[model samples]
Target: MLPAMIDIGVNLTDKRFADDREAVIERAREAGVSRLILTGTSLECSERALALCERFEGQLYFTAGVHPHHASEFGADSQRALESLAAHPACVAIGETGLDFCRNFSTPAEQTAAFERQLELACSTGLPLFLHEREAHSRQLDMLRACRDDFERAVAHCFTGTREELYGYLDLDLHIGITGWICDERRGAHLLPLLRDIPPGRLLLETDAPYLTPRDLRPKPKSGRNEPAYLPHIARRVASETGETEAALRARVLANSEAFFGL
Candidate 1:
């Protein structure tokens, strides 16, 4: 039997899963993905994520914060809402929050302000941070470093960055999350060598579902919607790249997720 694995990041709140979220989750369980941490990218989604966590109980958990893409939506009321959400027993972290300069969906100023506020929220709630970053790693790291001593823990979710950025995050002792992006032979080729750079205990695995479908899946799903069930495929690829047995990688990542998220 495959050992249990936790998908540290999944957007179960996405509209794509609306038709059959429960079925998707069941499929994940059968595929050995035993726990999931739903990501909240906005206020509404954060609330919805928490509700889903409550419904699924032990099998589902969630992060509460606004994404940098939606940073414009962050305002005076945002902190109050996030704080209330973070107080929930099912809310395991404070984010989906950080800078995303790759696409200026939200102004840089808005993104930075929102990111800082969420960092403060993480410190206030004493919850781990589930962070996101793109081309804005340098600035994100600056802000994170400023308050890094305050938060209990933090992970850079869906990391797809360069070696310098990866090492920068590692230098700060931040945890790194790997997604199916590593499966792509085109853009992800560089990540193959960087896998060995991550320290054993700081690496975490995720699907970032309804997005980043693993490109190498055989008989790939027609919908092209990634799910926790496909996590093993990503894991197999990581093991291959890092020169470790799939079983060993799975065990190590599972332990990392448990420790990082207090699972």
Candidate 2:
């Protein structure tokens, strides 16, 4: 039997998959992706994600927090709303939240405020965190360090950062979620050398589907749309880069995901 794998993050709520979400999920199952945690980037998306999780039951889970890009939308009712959503059994984490200076889609002040609020939510909810970070690593690390003790767990999702940044996160005891970004030849080259630094139990894998499709995929999907089905493809590349066999890497990541998300 194929080794089971869990995709720690997938944006199934994206409109691109609206027409055939069920079929997309079925393909993931055939690919040996046994579980998927759909990412929720906004309040509306969070609600939609939860609904999908309910529809899919044991096969789908979701995170409940605002992304930095929508930080400005976090309002007086945002915390209460997120907290309420988090109460659901299917709500697995408290974020896709953090700072992203690469594109100030939201002002730094808004992003910081929103990130801190979500950190508090994680602390209160006792749920793990699904975090994001771009060019604002320094500030992001500082905030996370200050609040790390309060939260149970956290991961830097879709990580593609500097060596110093990687060590900083690891020092904070944050798990690392690697996406297909590692398969990119131009921008992802630096990560190949750094993979060895991730301790055995701290590494997790995700597809961040419909976004960072592995460039190395043979006969790449004609639609150019990524889905959870490609996680094994990403895993194969990770194994090649890290000098571990594919089965071993898949087993390690699956175990890491189970512990990190309490699956």
Candidate 3:
């Protein structure tokens, strides 16, 4: 049998799981999710992520950086703080940071600045990047392409991009992460062809927990919080679309994740 899968982008700090975080993790483990990586959206959350990593140790890892929504809060000392947090043994990657033009929570300029700074840090530290990109894929790809000379490794986490954008990142030798969003029957149906195009070794999977829940499951809470336990559904859908066994997909995704994050 293949080893249990790893979810490389969950936000455990999200209040959606406040009532039952342990239950969620346990359920995930029971469902064959052996590990999870929590995303730290800001300095405070980065510290919290580290604490959770300490609590879970071998089972949980974390990334340290600010989300684009918090970009305006960054300052001269912010990168220093991020540097310190990233030095933690549990901190495995350097972002959930990038452009989020879909919401424009932060101005485009500030988002670009934050994203560049984090990329520089990740480059200097020789750690991989866990990036976010929404409607800003074109700009995001432009920035990454410009800075491609500096980055050693990167993954466009929760990828929602055009086939061209996907190939653009692949051209830069970056990995791609898929989330429960791919299992959505609505807007995500279009991703099936793109899924077919991605090579197994270049693909990693995430839950992006407390966020995009897969369809075809029983009803969720009234608030609709997603969790790592639902990760298998993402695997199921991918395996179905790719015409590969669930076991093989699970193992390939785990290997891709382990190699990307050096976990």
Q: Against the unseen true structure, what C-alpha lDDT does each candidate score?
A: 0.92, 0.94, 0.87
142 Cα displacement, candidate 1 (Å): 0.8
Model 1 over residues 57-147: C-alpha lDDT tens digits?
Answer: 9999999999999999998899999999999998899999999999989999999999889998899878999999888888888998998
TM-score of candidate 3 against the unseen true structure: 0.96
lDDT of 2 by residue, 111-197 (tens): 999999999999988999999998999999899889878999999999999889999999999999999998889899999989999
Candidates in order, TM-scores: namely: 0.98, 0.99, 0.96
Q: Which one is best on TM-score?
A: 2
On lDDT, the stronger of 2 and 3 is: 2
Q: Report the number of clashing residue pairs per model.
A: 0, 0, 0
Best by lDDT: 2
Model 1 quality (TM-score) = 0.98
Give the backbone clash total of model 2: 0
Worst 10 residues of 3 by lDDT: 215-224
Error of 1 at 27 (Å): 0.2
lDDT tens digits, residues 48-128, model 3? 889988999899999999999999988999999999988998889998898898898889999989988998998899888
Tell me how candidate 3 scores on lDDT: 0.87
